[model samples]
Target: MAALTLALDAMGGDNGPSIVIEALARALEQFPQHHFIVVGDDAELAELLAAKKLSNHPRVTVKHASQTVEMTDKPGYSLRAKPDSSMRVALDLVANDEAAACVSAGNTGALMTKAYFALKTLPGVLRPALMSAIPQASGKSAFVLDLGANPVCDSDTLFQFGVMGAVAAREVLGIERPRIALLNMGEEDIKGNDVVKSTAQLFQQSQLLNYIGFIEGDDLFADKADVIVCDGFVGNIALKSCEGLADLLLSNIRSNINAHWLTRWFVKLFYHRLQRSWDWLKPDHYNGASLIGLRGVVIKSHGDANTDAFFSAIQQAVEETQQDLPARIRDRVESVLLEQD
Candidate 1:
């Protein structure tokens, strides 16, 4: 992947343009092969960039957007009223081919709504799903999807998510012949609702997918499956639960280290090592989720993402662009369809 341009919604995150510009500074240094076009309130973004000494940087350009999408804005309302908003404008740049991808930490619903309209879904794609790689305790990560994109999904939609997730696992994560699994209450042959049963039948019948059996929520990071498929409702709850658990554990560990003298001494001895391990377990480490199956790359960072998390989202967008993920998913879906025919 040679040099490519990426559009950024500079006003999207909770910390405002300051975090975005700071991340851009780091990205510009780290990914010299990429150019950035940041969309936001021009004056504000310019000042922020100037503070980072990126205003005159050759690899970056600032585009003025009159509006900012708020976290509380309704998805439909944001789309209808904020055409020139930073989030919308950033996506428009992708749609017009002025940028290879867009990265935003804006409202997920608003971003998804605009991206569907702006970039459109790929041919043969029913709906774009939010896919993210969750770090596993087993020393490898697995890809999971439908992370709050569609609360209601039919068997066919879930199957399509399986295909998309597998392609992503293979292309993005370099997992060849990725094992795809349905997230269910149990791994038994007769364990789930009608939709899960139907989706299992579909996956089991598909010769292309490495369809493993169902996995319970406890197995999410067990690395038993390369790609876990679920409806958005389940996925969203599961992911947030994992994040919350991670936060709770981190907080407890820090609070407990000094609660016992022996424990305090032990932690002081291995403090650096334990801290390094704990840092990777944080919610912000890999914060971006790709809105896959779109015509262009769109990475949605957590709305309250810090600089590191936002930068991770930018990296996610770049990796997807480099892999030509849309093309891969589109072609794979075409192949699957033709095979069925």
Candidate 2:
């Protein structure tokens, strides 16, 4: 196989260079054949690399950019006004085939906007959706799409998401005939709004997808579905709610144990078990979300991602690159769209 080069948007995310630098170092150690082109201001990146003693790595290089698009900046304005921004430069690398993939922990909206405009989409793809995998109960994970990519979507768009998500599950998760479900308010066929009802009907009729009917929010971690499709608005709400509930459960568990000496002793007895369970639920374990249906691979990490999260994002980029996710999704989407035509 050819060498895989990844473009890292160094100026992105809340932690900036620190998290990116750490992730680069860690990834280089794990996958020595992989190379990275860090995009940011030359002088600042150089100083940081020197401080970390990473300037000598053969697999790492820096590409300088003078400006950065802030998280609060409007996606359209940033893409149009700041042509030389790190995010734009990163996309250019993938567009020109200089990089196998691009990863950013920046403004999700801006990154997706830039990617869609610069790289465009597969021939028949109406829109690209962001798909992220979340850990479930059976030592497995579920893929959720439109996780803040297109907040408002029509039935056709949701149907596209289902196809794109199923392709991703097969490629990334190595699942044959991956089970798919639409995110809905009820399990019955006539439960959701018109968009959901229409999309459900489409899935039910389509032979390309393994549509398993409606899945409510509670079924997210039940392992009933391998890929869950929803509009970006509902997907974002589901993701945030899961994270919030995880935090609350962990806190409640800790507080209950600390309330009394006997409880503390019991907690200490089961500390390792508790830690193991909590580790499985941490966001770091599943840190990367791919923007599906684009011409190239673009993985987005959380803005508040730590070093571990950044590292996991890099691993995800490598895995998706190896799986050739973009090509797989393109093929699947083309087939479905052709059938519709």
Candidate 1 residue lDDT tens string, 223-274: 8999999999999998888778877877788778878888888986676787
lDDT accuracy of residue 2 in candidate 1: 96
User: Model 2 residue 46 lDDT?
Assistant: 86
Candidate 2 residue lDDT tens string, 50-102: 88899967989899987898999999999989889988999899999999899
Could you tell me the TM-score of candidate 1?
A: 0.95
* TM-score, candidate number 2: 0.94
Q: In the order shown, what is each candidate's alpha-carbon RMSD?
A: 1.6, 1.8
Leading candidate by TM-score? 1
User: Candidate 1's C-alpha lDDT?
Assistant: 0.90
**Alpha carbon lDDT of residue 277, candidate 2?**
76
Displacement of residue 227 (Cα, Å) in model 2 is: 0.7
